[model samples]
Every structure is written in structure tokens, then in C-alpha cells.
Target chain A: MSPSVAYGTDIDERTKAAEQSATDVLTAPDIPWNLVIWNDPVNLMSYVSFVFQSYFGYSESKAHKLMMEVHKKGRSIVAHGSKEQVEQHAVAMHGYGLWATVEKAASGNETPGKGGRQRG
Target chain B: MAKAFKYGLKGISGYLEPAERDLLRGLLDDVISMLESDVRENEDPLAALIGLDMDVKQPGDRALLRLLPNVMKDDDGGSLEFRQLTERSVRESKIGALRAAALGLDKNELVLTPDDATRWSMALNDVRLVLAERLDIRDEADAEHIHSMQDWSQAEDVESYLALVYNFTTWLQESLVQAMMAARQAKS
Candidate 1:
């Protein structure tokens, strides 16, 4: 069978190109990463908010919002940037006694499939 | 009461009476000692406490794990490697911070410089971590258990005393953080 016949006739050129583009983007090494802070029982809520403010230079309101997000939602993407940037933020957060990790941010509507492991 | 925060342009100029200063100094001193011992243990777990017949167990040591958490939670090998690469520097930084805070305690009224504020933040956090681990404080209930048993007389169990310290440090750190944020806002 020909290459087109082997696949389905329903697959159009546009759909195939879109899929290829998505794969290329996702596979690229420069995907944006998120520095996530996880809520834990040990650290105080006020301390967590303070960390967000002092370290990230976030405004008080913004810091409080992120802190509450982490508190109520279990985790929050406190920062988003290149891998190194996010990793640095994660390390800084760790130094401040916050439970933090770095993970690749899922782009667009695409679900972050497997291997979405958190890194410190 | 918690440590009273006195914010200034330089940083928090918090006043600690002689007794308060002594209390903080004592706590930070303890933390410094704990961290120093941990460093020694890390170098050679068995040799570090050979005379004391103590074993330095990694990950299993609740206080050690809390103070220097595993960066990689899912992979044991990766976590071990991460600890190997970063734990020493982390421990040193924590020790440095604690020592700096200890220096501030010499004065009856401890004034934290901007840098000192940051150091105090980190140092106090470590103190809380160690206390949390020792208290087996997994949640609010665990903390409350200690709080409910508080006695001003030095007669109650040590857990109550430790709980008082933990709560006091939490407030101190919170106030320091607030002062820092306010200072940052003022600068901008």
C-alpha cells in the first residue's frame, strides 16, 4: 500500500502539518519551565507569602495571591521562564525552606503527557 | 508574644530584651551546632559519630530530611545525587545565616540589616524545620497537641517548650518577611 493508503484518507495535509508542528514545538529543548511551590504542613502561610515577595520581587498582593493558590490548590507556578531560570528559582525557594520544584510548563491546550516529573 | 518588628530603611530594627536576645541566641546557637554536626556526618557517616556511637542515616533522619529536603522526590538515585551535589553548600549557607543571626543577638536590641533580615529569614526557617521534625508535627493537629500542653513553669514536657519556640520563630519570620516586603515596596 502507498504511504497515504497505509494511513487513513480522513487525515488531511493541514492536520498532518499541524501535528508535525506541535511535535516539533513540544520536542524542542527550549520549552518554557515553571517553578512550582508546593504547600506543606511545616512552613507557615505567612512565611510562604513572604518568600514569594522577597525572592521574586512580587508585590504584596501578587505574593499573597500566589501563596493562597499554593495553599488552596496544593501548588502554584510561582515563576515561568527558561529551564535555568526556573531551576534557579526552585533552588532559591528551597533555601528559604519552601517546598519547590521545577517542571516544564504545558503549552496551550495540549495535556502534559507522561514524564511530567517535578525537579528541584 | 512574638518578636516585635521595628522596620527601618536599612531593614528591621527589632528590639529584643536581654532575655529575648538570649533566647534567640540560644536557639540559633543550637541550630548552628546541629548543622555543623550534620556537615561532619555527611563527610563520613560512620566516622562522624564514632566516639558517640551514633549513626547518621540519610533520608531516614527526619530532621535532616526536613532541613535538606530531597530535591528529586520520585527517583531515589537522582535524589541521592542531588543531595550529594548540593547538600553541603546548602548546609553551609544555612550555617552562615544562623551565625549571622547569632551575631545580631549580642546586642540587647537586635537590629537586622537588610542582609541580616534575609539571613534571619533563612536561619529561623531552619530552626522551625528541625523543631517540626522533632515534634513529629505532620499537621495542625500535631502542632496543636503540643500547644495544648503549654506551661509557663519549666515543669511541663520539653515538647511544649519546643512548641513555644516554634510558634515564636514563625511569628518572627513572618514579621521580618512583612518588613522586607514593605521595604521593597518603598524602594520601588
Candidate 2:
């Protein structure tokens, strides 16, 4: 008596892979939102950074970088995450007295380049 | 006692400048009284709202941080402008000092916040350092630092100023949280 081993199917690896990929995409958070802070006549920049750092637990350097983005670019995306995550951050920022909001993130906007502006 | 976020713990105590000390004492008392009254008169939503708005306390880095601007305006139209500047230019010491003086405060009167001089000075210094580092104004002439906003002052203007800033901030803060929540909801 001979026992034969049978491999069920090698016919649809590609299809299975595609299905997995689709499911991953579906489960992922869609519509990236930016947590923006507008420039105001009140609310000091340092205070803004302090808020960012204290509320979000951002490092001093990270907080300052975000603050400058708000100061120079007129608004900033301090955090990027699922909608609920960003909303929580916005509320925290508000609590700290910084004007903050979340909006649809622009496409292809990569993270800060060159790090600091290297200003004199 | 151990605290998670110890924002306002001054090392030196009770060294506030005369003007600043008086302002702190006055604001502290008024806010406290209003809050207490609001608790009793919770029936009035507006009053309660105002009290909640005024109850904000940042208490970070040793500076007695209070949220919700409360400026009082008078027939003469003074002080609101000064308080407005103080809120905006929170990081500048020299400018804040000058601004305080400009708004009818004598130099000596603005010397030290009587609440706790060492702590107050340290907090002020910390604010100054942070501002200097973060403030990359294209040139030295960029807006005369932070306190330039206060060119004048009035005694009663604090409440009105606070009211305006509070309303705007509240709206924005609410909107921001809502929008973010909506996005989150959509995501989930």
C-alpha cells in the first residue's frame, strides 16, 4: 500500500493576494486630515509651542518646528492620524489655548524637509 | 505631592510687580467669586458658561496661566487693548513689561509680580528664552517683538476683551473637535 500526498491548489495565489491587499486597504483609515492652527493676533508663538508640547507630548524641537510652520506658512499640521486621533489632539490644543482644527490633508505633502530652516 | 503635568510651580514665591501683583490678585478674586456665584446660579446658562470659560487655568511653567480673556471697557475706551497684547505676546518679558508700563503702569510698579518673584522671574525668563528661539522674524524690526499690540489701556476693558476672545476660541475649539470627530467617525 502506497500513501499519496496531494497538494490541494497552486492555482490562485495571485487572486488570494489581491483579495488580502483589498481587505487591508478597506480596513485602513481613509482621508488623511491635518490638525491646523491659524495665526492669530493673540496667543503668543511660544505659548503655542508650549501648548503643542504640553498637550501632545511633543519634544521642544518638534513643538517649535510645528509653531514655525503655523507662523510662516499660516497654518500647520501638527499631527496626522485617524480622524478620532486627530480630533482628540485638536481638543487638547484648544484646551491649551491654541486655535486648532482638522482639515483634509493635501495630496503628496511629505513631512518637513531640511528639518529646520537653518535661519540665522 | 506628585503631579503628572506640573505646569505652574514657581520656585520663588510672592515677588510679583506691584501692577502685575494687583492684577493677579484682582483677577484671581474676581474669577473665583464669579465661579462661586455661577455654581449657585447654574440656572443661567450664559452666566455658567462665562464662569466655565473664565475658569481656565494653564498653570504651566510656573506662570499662572489663565484661559479666557476678561477685559473691561469703559466710556474712555482703555485697558482692553493692553490686556489683548498681554495675551498675544505672552513670551516676551521686556516687551510685556514695557507694554504693562505703557498702559498706565509705572516702571517700579511693574518691577516684579508679588505672587512669587523668583518663580515669576523664572517663568518670565523661560517664556523669553522660548520666544527668542522660536521667533525667527525675518529681521529685528519684525513687529517690535510681541507686546507691541498694547498701545493703550483701560480698566474695564478686560471683560469685553475676554468675552470676544473666549467666544471665538470656544467656537473654533468646538468646531475643530467636531470636525476631527466627524473625520474619525468616517474612518471607523
Candidate 3:
């Protein structure tokens, strides 16, 4: 039998699969999650930028750029980190009255149908 | 008077004259009453034992739903349960903030503890959300249209009036956030 196969029954295939899963878990930190803020009709652009600057410590210019992106693009990736970290961010944004969500960064490009009616 | 906010080691501070304060007080009170009236004691003795209440129906109002978002987008059952468990606390916190703001109105000066500052920020955002819904404010042009009309006397247009309130609340909320940020920056 090949070195890849263990002596026991179907355990060899199961072992390889488990090993692959373990490797994926070990590399998981590199696969970042994104905290996305969706535009709302109610939230002011200036207020959004201020929240970005206040909570995230982003500079004025950077915050403004992101705010504009959220306005024009309907959503913006505001932060990137592990799942727990991004979830915390999304909750905090919700607390600040902005619509927010977290998703795998690799899958961030998928845009769900917009929720609220569009504002200007 | 133009609304403004200031920050220091003493905490965040702002001024509102009697008329302005009254207007704000009324607005806060309105939202608080709306949120509070939604809750009622759980009638079932069995349910009461576990701290569950069926009286406060889940908020069917769009504005209320917006204020309380689901934790999980993928799981409908989980999200509904989460909202059921959390709706009361969220409404209470919102009411608490409005009351905190009301406390400062009589004095014409509002001073918030760091914690209260955060609450005020959140509460102000809620007020704006409610008003925005009423105004049908959908984007920059809508806001600008109202801004352009601010100088005119729109005595008949209820939306025009609500728009003014919305704009003022936005300024107030922005100032609070900026003040908090400045204080944080100073600490570092």
C-alpha cells in the first residue's frame, strides 16, 4: 500500500480528510472576514464618517472616502479581521445605528439584494 | 441657536436655549413614549417565572425593526428568537438615553458622562431614524431640497418641519460623536 494509506480499513481516506481540514483551520487566520456597512436613507454622510473615525480611529480623509463609497456603492467593506473581530465590529456599527454585517472576505463581492429603499 | 458640541476631561457638553431645549425634549419624549408603550407585563404566571413577556408584541413597525437588527442573517429562526429575547432591553436602553437627555433640558446645558455620551449618541441616531422615515428623506438631493427650503416659511408642510428636526438632530449627533473622538484623541 502507498504511504498515504493507513493499514486500517477506510480510515486512510478519513485521516487524509481530517488532516486537510486541520490544515485549513491552521491557515484560517489568513482568510480574513470583512465587516460591511450598508447605506441607509436615514444616516447622514457626515455622521457615518464621524463614526468611522471615532470608532475605528480612521483619519478624516480615509473615513470620508469610505463614507462616500458607502453612499455611492450602497455598501463598503469597513474592516477586515478574524470572524470574531469582524462580528464585534458589525455589532458596534449596528449600535451606532448603521446597518452592518460580516462575511468572509473572499466572498465579500457577492451583493445581496438591497434592503432599505434607496435615498439620494 | 446653531447646535454645537464641546468635549473636555469633564465629559461632553452642549448648550440649548429654552425654546430649542423644549423642542428637543418634546422629540425625545415622543420617541420614548412610543417605545415604552410597546411593552406590557407578561400576564401568564408560568411565563412570568422565566422573565418572558408575550404582552410586548414584537415590534411590527419598520422603524422599530430598523432600530433592532438581527444578529444572524442566515438563520431566520435564530434571528427571531434573538430579537424576542433582546427587544425589551434594547427599547429600555433607548428610553433611558432619551430620559438622560431630558434631564439636561431644564438647565439649558447638557453634560454627559462618558457612558451617557455614548447613550446620547445612540439615542440621537434613533430619533433621526424615526424622523427620516416620516420625511421620506432618501438621499443627498432630498436633504438638500429641504435645506434650500429652510429659509422659506413652509407653515403647511409637515415634512418640511420634520426635515428641519432631522437636520438639527443630525448636527447634534455629529457633534457628540466628534466631541467623543476629540476626547479620545486627547487621552492618547
Candidate 4:
């Protein structure tokens, strides 16, 4: 297999930076965007979790947690980064046949790891 | 009958009958054709080389749109801009995987390398996505209705046949993913 991108490995650090930036008044360019995975009937649950684990380099349990959130809540903000970063992830998700979209973090109701901070 | 894919000492492997292999090849080909772009005489060579498609519009076909979805949630302009810059490459990569997987269907004894397994998983997922759209699987309940049509003897019409095919691919993909997870665990 090709070397998986370690995007999820540094997510906690980025999330902390995002939270710190959120506290200060920020400009438009400084605002973070989210990569949201939406639930669809066609994608198998196992396949969806696999994509999260392989593509994002997320732990199996963390990937399953996000997959369940998508299944139950209809969508989940699986990652947050600069617009360019999240958009790149969105394209990768589409390539894997997962229904994904990008949105401004403030516009969405959830943030990455908002459900629980404990790592699985 | 086909065996579910499994991970073992020699990587991932599965078995499919000749008829089942032909069915999957046809499905993969269909998705590839849907993703292939039409060449225009007036298109700029440089832009095409760089994978730019300024004239690319949002796919009107529901199935096509599902495969190549809008990137942004609410901004059409933003989504279009992003699509113009990246949609061509996305379509090309998807077509590449579909074609590779189709080529691998030539034999009944399928042994896949890690890269091949990833491509096969992607190819199977795309096939299922298109089949689901045709079957009008709008929600979990609709998927359940389709999934319930597993008896091949009951395929009396096009829809029933499609439902069966969809279910078959779903089962195949689910097993492939499970095997992939097992492989990942072994490596790490």
C-alpha cells in the first residue's frame, strides 16, 4: 500500500491550536474549516470506518467512533484544518466513494473531538 | 458462489465463479464510462495536461453527482471553483482504480497485493454507489428493502436483478474491508 498520510496523527495539536485561535479575534483567513462525512445508505459501515482509519491514519477505535456518529447523527466533522487542507481531505474522501463536504468550523454545530476528548 | 475475501499468510485472496467475475467486470466498466470525460476540439491542451476543466459542470445524473460530490456544503460558487481545479483528476483516479480492478477479474482465483486490494475496495464501492442510486436507496430503510432481495431465484425483473447485484457487491466489499483491517493489524 502507498504510505498513508499521517493527517490524523497531529490532529490533537491542530485542534488545540484552533481552539487557541478561536479565543482571539481572528481574520477570515485564520478561520478553520471542517471536513464533514455524511451518512449514506450505500456505503458499508465497515468500509467507511476503514477509509477513516487508512486515509486519515486514525486509530481503529477512533475511526469507529466517528463512523458511529455519522451513522446516528447523520454527519460528523471528522477533521478540521485550513480550507485548503480540509478541501484536500474532502477530495480524498470522494475518491474513496465516501460522501464528504467542507464547511467553515463556526458554521457547523460540532467540532472535531467535541463529543469526547478521550482517545480510544 | 464466491468466497468472501480473507487475509492469510500470502496477503488477501478470494474466489469467484466465471459468471460472477463477468458481472463485476461489466459493473466496473459502466462506472468507468460514467466518469470518462468527453474530449472537446477547442479545449486548451495546457489546461487539460494540468487536469483543469474550467467548463466542467456539476453532474446532472444523480449517480454521477454522488460519486463526484460538491466539496463545499452551501457555496455553489466555491464548489464550482474547487471542482474546476480538481474534478478532472478525481474522475481520472477513480477510473484508473475501476479499470485496474476490472482487469484483475480475468481469473477466478484472485490474489491481491495491498495496493490492489485498496483499488479493488474503491472500485467495488463505486459500483455499489451507482447501483444504490439506480435502486433508489434514499435511506437505511430503502437499503434494507434492497438487501432483503438476496434470493437469486426471485430476480424476475430489472429492479430485482439490480437489487441482487447491489447486495452481492455489498457483501463482497464488506468482506474485503474486514480482510483489509486484519491485514493492517498484522502489519502494525
Best by lDDT: 4
Worst 10 residues of 4 chain A by lDDT: A111-120
lDDT (0 to 1) per candidate:
0.69, 0.40, 0.70, 0.88
Q: Which residue runs of candidate 3 sit more than 4 Å off their true CA positions? A: A1-34, A53-65, A79-91, A102-120, B8-11, B43-58, B70-78
* True lDDT of residue A90, candidate 2: 50
Q: Per-residue CA lDDT of candidate 2, range B49-114, in tens?
A: 432333323234222232322222121122233233333233233233323323332332223222
Candidate DockQ values, in order, are 0.22, 0.05, 0.19, 0.63
| Best-matching candidate per DockQ | 4
TM-score of each: 0.74, 0.39, 0.71, 0.88
- Rank all candidate structures by their DockQ, best first, as comma-separated numbers: 4, 1, 3, 2
What candidate 4 gets wrong by more than 4 Å, as runs, is A1-31, A114-120, B37-41
Off by over 4 Å in 1: A1-29, A81-83, A104-120, B1-3, B9-11, B40-58, B144-155
Candidate 1, residues B1-188, lDDT tens digits: the string is 33567677546777667877778888888878876774443445543333221233355667866776765446556556555555666667788999988887876666666778888888888888888888888876786675565456743667777777777777777777777767665666
Residue B98's lDDT within candidate 4 is 100
Candidate 2 regions with alpha-carbon error over 4 angstroms: A1-31, A109-120, B1-14, B17-19, B28-188
Give the winner by lDDT: 3 or 4.
4
Worst 10 residues of 1 chain A by lDDT: A111-120
Q: Write the per-residue lDDT of candidate 3 for residues B37-146, one digit (tens) a residue.
A: 75555467776455455454446776766776665556556555645554555666677878887776777677777778777887788888878766766776776775
Give the CA lDDT, 0 to 100, for residue B85 in model 2: 30
